[model samples]
Target: MVSKLKMVLIFISIPVISLFAQDKPELHVGGALRFNYNLSSWKEGQKTRGGDFGYDLFRINAKAKYKGVKLNAEYRLYSQGFGGGMLKQGWVGYDFTPENNLQIGLTQVPFGITQYNSHNWFFSINYYLGLEDDHDMGLKYTHNSENWLYAFAFFKNAEELNFGNNSDVSNSRYSYDVSSSGDGLYRNKEINQLNLKVVRKFSNGGANHMLGVSAQYGGIYNLDTENTGDHLALAGHYELDFGKLNVKAQVSKYNYNTKNPAGQSNDMIAMTAYGAPYLVASEGTTYTLGVAYSVPVEWGPISNLQFYDDFGFMDKKLNDFHDSYMNVTGVLITAGNVYTYVDAAQGKDQPWLGPVWGGALSEGTANADWEMRFNINIGYYF
Candidate 1:
């Protein structure tokens, strides 16, 4: 007896396989296995350092393209406490022209920098706020030319197939998790969200520069509380590239507002997918600066060596809350299909700061006036 879930998977695969069999679509299969080793220390409490080692993640991605139609999907398994097996992205798209396309399914939202240029496996702070690796069931239209890129998308839900929270009251304090209790900052499960981004590029003095603007609006209604809350963000980013050197920076201001039947404000604390959520006075500004320098080296099997620094800062609107910031410095070594990242990071008033590859430090209770973590990640792709 096949389970219903398995049956659904089989049904979804039929058309994909048929396309390859009949239309002879181009197919590609690839995957990566990642591992991590970490050591961490805190400023106030434990005088001794703590460490851990484990498999970070295993991921497989497949894509097929025939004429103007394409399909892309990825399956991921996480070993850390993050979660279990899940679909990272699965989308089908149609290309009307080389520069224009329409995508429908579970895909990334077009907001802020699409890719972080950090050498560390862990991305900057924006990632936690649904700016990186954030995907949803939606429809997106994209247009790209030699000098301009534009994207607009609408998502029915911020996340799909989440079973972590079943209770009416959201006990979890994260944004990515479904919250029924209203404890979750982004508790609205049925989110009607819209996102937009536009960028323009130019070249000067052997370098390329890009400037862009991004915006997002999302809302969810809590049936239990008969209230509604919404998330809003507006941001701008700039990127500069000179041969082997690259610099990227972005600034964003966001607000989460809620209203009840009594006309009273019930704005919850701001939270991310992971780490400790903080109280916001309704709005805050986040900034990220990342710089990378690639060095051409022919040492052993090493093809490239890149050193980088990624910094993130958050300024809360509330006067009672202290500012938060994180700084990560790392080196990336690439040898053929294998890549390694060695990183050192520290932060204050930021419990979410850690390795991108998982396994570093646990959430601390006290404000991290100064906490440090060292991490190393190795991955191989085939």
Candidate 2:
């Protein structure tokens, strides 16, 4: 099933490519190297267990554009380089009006209030939004008018899971009967997302401030039979630019329902309820806040330095009566969730500081727990 999906995407890209061949080509290439140090254990008694020399995450991204079409791709290299891989975002878009555009292909699903705000890179602020944790390969349409912006997308449930070349496959068929032995998670899984966003700009401190609201509906197909589940999410973000300094905040709320896949497929009748098929769902809220200052610095091979920080926090209400932190916003906000808690604090700000032009001083946060992280980054842009 995975192999077939790849073929289909490849076939679709051909036409999208031809539509731009007659226009002037546009290409943009950039990447980031992030060397992170986990100061302490994210969980009280748990310690981070991956990365070489405490080196946490690194990413490389490139894009090419022609006329109204763009092709983008990214590679995320993580600790151990084991669960890191690449993804392609191919799309063609046309202007419907001066401010509205229609696009079709793999694109960013704008849902969570924090998901669309690109300035959360330098602080421990969590006041925006959070929802589905992955991207999609499907069709997307966007509209950006004067005071309002809207976006919607239809996506195939599959996202690259950093397993090397196999990052693009979605159909993970578990060989088993509905009542017997199988990888219950992927056997009959289907996923989809519908996202909407609205933004209103205002003024504060003699700077531009924008307030954004987002809503999303997502789920895997046959969630009841396949035991996947469904979710509803809402989020909001506010950005206030104050001359040389800027501040931003965002908030998010979520409600979810999920069914735990049972023992294999065909052998369920005699199963015990203790470990039987069931659902572990949750309702949660998250918030983020950030502050930044852009300072001019004339130094060796450097342009300017931006110092920033962000904080985020999330609280989860569980349905399965489990005490685990998997559903806890604090844990999931990290870079790799509980699996690697390091991500609990990270964002675009750190990379901006280290990008070769902006001198050391730029850093951001992902998790809004009491523990905060700061980076001394040096950056340069051509």
Q: lDDT of all the models against the reference?
A: 0.70, 0.45
Best by lDDT: 1
Q: Which segments of model 1 are wrong by more than 4 Å?
A: 1-22, 43-50, 117-119, 162-186, 260-267, 270-282, 354-367
Compare the candidates by TM-score and give the number of the best one: 1
Question: In candidate 1, what residue range of length 10 has the lowest lDDT sum?
Answer: 355-364
> Which lDDT tens digits does candidate 2 get at residues 1-382?
9999999999999988887664878788776565444332233332344322345445566777666666666655554332333343445666656677766655666764434333333223221112422345567677776666677777665442324421222222111001111233322232576777778867655888778888877773333354556667788878777787777676777665545355422211110011122112245566656566766655543445455555554454533221111111121111211111222343322212212111111112333223323322222211
Scored by Cα lDDT, where does model 2 land? 0.45
Q: TM per model?
A: 0.81, 0.59
Model 1 earns a TM-score of 0.81
